[model samples]
Target: MNFALGFKTTMGESGSMEALEKQLICPICLEMFTKPVVILPCQHNLCRKCASDVFQASNPLWQTRGSTTVSTGGRFRCPSCRHEVVLDRHGVFGLQRNLLVENIIDIYKQESKRPLQPKAEQQQLMCEEHEEEKINIYCLTCETPTCSMCKVFGAHKNCEVAPLQTIYNRQKTELGDGIAILVAGNDRVQAVISQMEDVCRTIEVRITEVHLPKAQL
Candidate 1:
């Protein structure tokens, strides 16, 4: 089935707000629509910045600074509907309530066809373009963490070597869920340690009080 039909079918299960959003998205940006600017005359809508960029690319003369005239700006047409829409009279707004509806519909479809984690893990591992030094060890090819000697003499030759820290940061961003899980675990550990410290302090105080009373008696 087409995306529109599937979108509608999934949206039927969602609330009213979702149904309105499915039509509001800019075809370029797959995410929620932003700065929705409607084309004049045709009444079709596109993201403001996206539409301008499209127009500029379509007409090379539009890019030259101070070279454009009033007529030059009006000559550009909408790429999608091929309709004439002038930028001067049009206004931009951040009306994203309709965009949210489409997101909800898409999210529902993705949830319904959830991928099996175990099955995904069973798939073959893809090879990285960077030269392989060892089983999993990477050959940086002297571009980053790897040294010049390693690039020339070692298994790592001229290859696209990225910094280890950069790789680590990207992985962290991608595995945000894993980071949340780790944070929760660390919090639990801290709570347990705090409780144990309190218990130890109470035990020491009780011992001191009991011993002094017994010695005096």
Candidate 2:
């Protein structure tokens, strides 16, 4: 799927919104990420559940159906970059959640939920090739937005096409799930920031106390 989000002004072609959307999809499930999305050591993100599955599959004991279970500290390769990832005692739970990705997902969901005005829809519905035609079809093969004329006579004439509405609905659902994941990530980041701020405050106070004694002397 062209996971790109497009922006059209009733008369303009969609921008790179579709491209941005694609980045949020999990390679393992081929869907938008779920809650507790983990950033692997290689910097690739995966849904926590998907990471757990990969970790289990990599274990010889798990594959043989042996009664012995490996500790969460086992290692697994990243599904995307194939980088080796060593988990902590909590396994995938020990991996850092990507707050930035989660925040973008939340913003996208909010924007998606907003009803587009008739004027805005008209501005965003036009095709780049057929300026007069609204984008009514999605080219499944090429993963591009197309006007009816494009389907009949343009480059996508021989390609598989689906109604734009269907794709739109599906993308909306994916965005909704993304929002949930982002919320959890945001909380995790906030906690860390808070802890770091407290540590900094303590160090500042200690430094001030040490300096005060020297100045008094």
- Which numbered prediction scores highest in lDDT against the true structure? 2
lDDT by residue (1-217, candidate 1, tens digit) is 6765565455443343355556555765644455444443565566667766666665555443353352334245655577765543222222222343445446555644544335454443333333443222234444334543455565465565554557657668879978899999999999999999999999998888888866575
What's the lDDT for residue 207 in model 2? 89
- The local distance difference test score of each candidate is 0.54, 0.78
Models 1 onward score TM values of: 0.29, 0.45
Give one digit per residue, the lDDT tens place, for model 2 in 38-79: 888888999889998998788644332254334536788888
Q: Look at candidate 1 and tell me the lDDT of residue 133.
A: 37
Regions of candidate 1 where Cα sits further than 4 Å from its true position: 1-15, 64-71, 86-217
What is the Å distance of residue 28 in model 1 from its true position?
Answer: 3.0
Model 1: lowest-lDDT 10 consecutive positions: 89-98
- Each prediction's number of clashing residue pairs: 2, 15
